[model samples]
Target: MSDIEIIKAKRAGFCFGVKRAVNITFKAAKKGKGVFTLGPLIHNPQVIEKLCKEGVCPTENTEDRNIQTLIIRTHGIPLELYQTFLKKDFKVIDATCPFVKKAQQYAKLLCDEGYQVIILGDEKHPEVKSLMSYAGKDAIILDSNQELQKIKNKKRVGVVVQTTQPTNLLQEFIGKLVSRVSELKVFNTICNSTALRLKETKEIARRVDLMIVAGGKNSANTTQLATLCNASSVKTYHIETSSEIKKEWIKDVARVGITAGASTPEWIISEIESRIRDIGGNGDNGYPHESGRN
Candidate 1:
């Protein structure tokens, strides 16, 4: 077999907000006073399972009001839910990413100023739901510009986007909105980490034979990474762990590129690179300690 080269993107794995949220959750678990989180602390299932082992339970039922502490996920919750939790006498820790908080702030601001708040994201996504709550129940969620047809006779529109969405999508959403609303106030809330990941994914994809996007299959950002890479017309695969790397995908491929979503863990990315290396080599049985990136 010809030697296969692997290029890992430098921006792969956990971003600042995810890192900060995970760090805080882990520390909360150490307190041992029945710590729990509103949801899987982040999108990575492996990390969530490990956190469970560390006594950080992910709870959606939340009937255990006696719980000592509750850590909010990286995506902030609605203001009413936060107040409700506080009223229930739980020691709520706001681990919401600062970027998400900023979006929520914009939503509230737009509502206060009487602009029809339109969020550029999936309506069901926690981040978008949180923003809409601040914008009032009637606030619109525009996952794509096509949704705009549902709105008629609107005088003013204000926009805020879920931070994980790609810049192109946001631009597309905004461009379509220009003809729909009389007054437009745009607060582009895409986080720095997301911008970097999207940019780096394309850069690595263009230079490699096959691109591996590592992160939770359920993660929107991870899916977007794969979509962005595929748009470059390179073969792309999205996997949550090393075990998902199929041999056929590597066969006859001389160069491999790897990039991951913001919520992905570095260890998982390393494992994936090792697996790719093993499959490409002739039972060499050894792999690089660290993946190469640019």
Candidate 2:
């Protein structure tokens, strides 16, 4: 009998915002003949595929005349894009996450108040781009690891973060900026779900011999979990689905842990857990170390 044990993070998979967006899209699909999302509703490809089967599809641009209904992505679209879509004949459904919407509002507020806005996140991420649009042309985007460059003569500075940023990263950056600007206004825009998932994943990584991080490779939060696991010096594999799990990775491992990103679905996590059992896990014992949180 295999002695290997498997544990799953209680906080893993399908954060509130993702669930809300998916549910709204599915509901919309049931009510209409032609429903389209401005982009993939979330970062998970498997979820997107399922939506496609339901007659819900993603359109990169709003140029199609055949588009009858348009749903905003969870990450949200730029202010101008959203405004332009409203002028079209198609019905518009906004499924943007409330947290992301809050960040956008704060960015716009800061800009209008004459504070030079600084956003903390990957510059290329859709969420960050949306925040930048609200912050106006002079706003700056900074990565967590990017060095803080000295500002020339800005007096008041305002900071807003992507909803998925690490809490510690925001704190660290804010500390550095306080001394540089005469007035510093900071909004802790990081979502509580993202913070808790990272904390739980790190704890699981420290206790397990190997970690299986499940989510789309393109998902920012999913990749962040893998990066955190690797930094903890544990063997980690970031997979989109159960099929990506390799037999060799679990060989000789006494304990394996499973964690998923905000966009990951419960079914994907369950499938991965079952795959681990078929490979080398000793069954469901210690499988779900429930923390009473989803």
Best by TM-score: 2
Q: Count the backbone clashes (under 3 Å) in each candidate.
A: 0, 0
Compose the digit string of candidate 2's lDDT tens values, residues 1-108: 345688899999999888999999999999987899987888899999999999999998778887899999889889988899899999999989999999999999
Q: Estimate each model's TM-score.
A: 0.86, 0.88
- Off by more than 4 A, model 1: 1-3, 149-153, 231-233, 246-252, 282-294
For residue 92, give model 1's deviation from the true position in Å.
0.6
Superposed by TM-score, candidate 2 places the C-alpha of residue 275 at a distance from the truth, in angstroms, of 2.4
lDDT of 1: 0.85
lDDT of 1 by residue, 1-294 (tens): 225798998999999999999999889888777899987888889999999899888888667865789999988998889889888767889999999999999899998998888888888888888888898655888888778886653787888998878788988888888887788999999887888888888988999989999999888789999999989999998999999887877776778999998889999999998888778632333333234421
Task: State in Å the error of residue 8, model 1.
Answer: 0.7
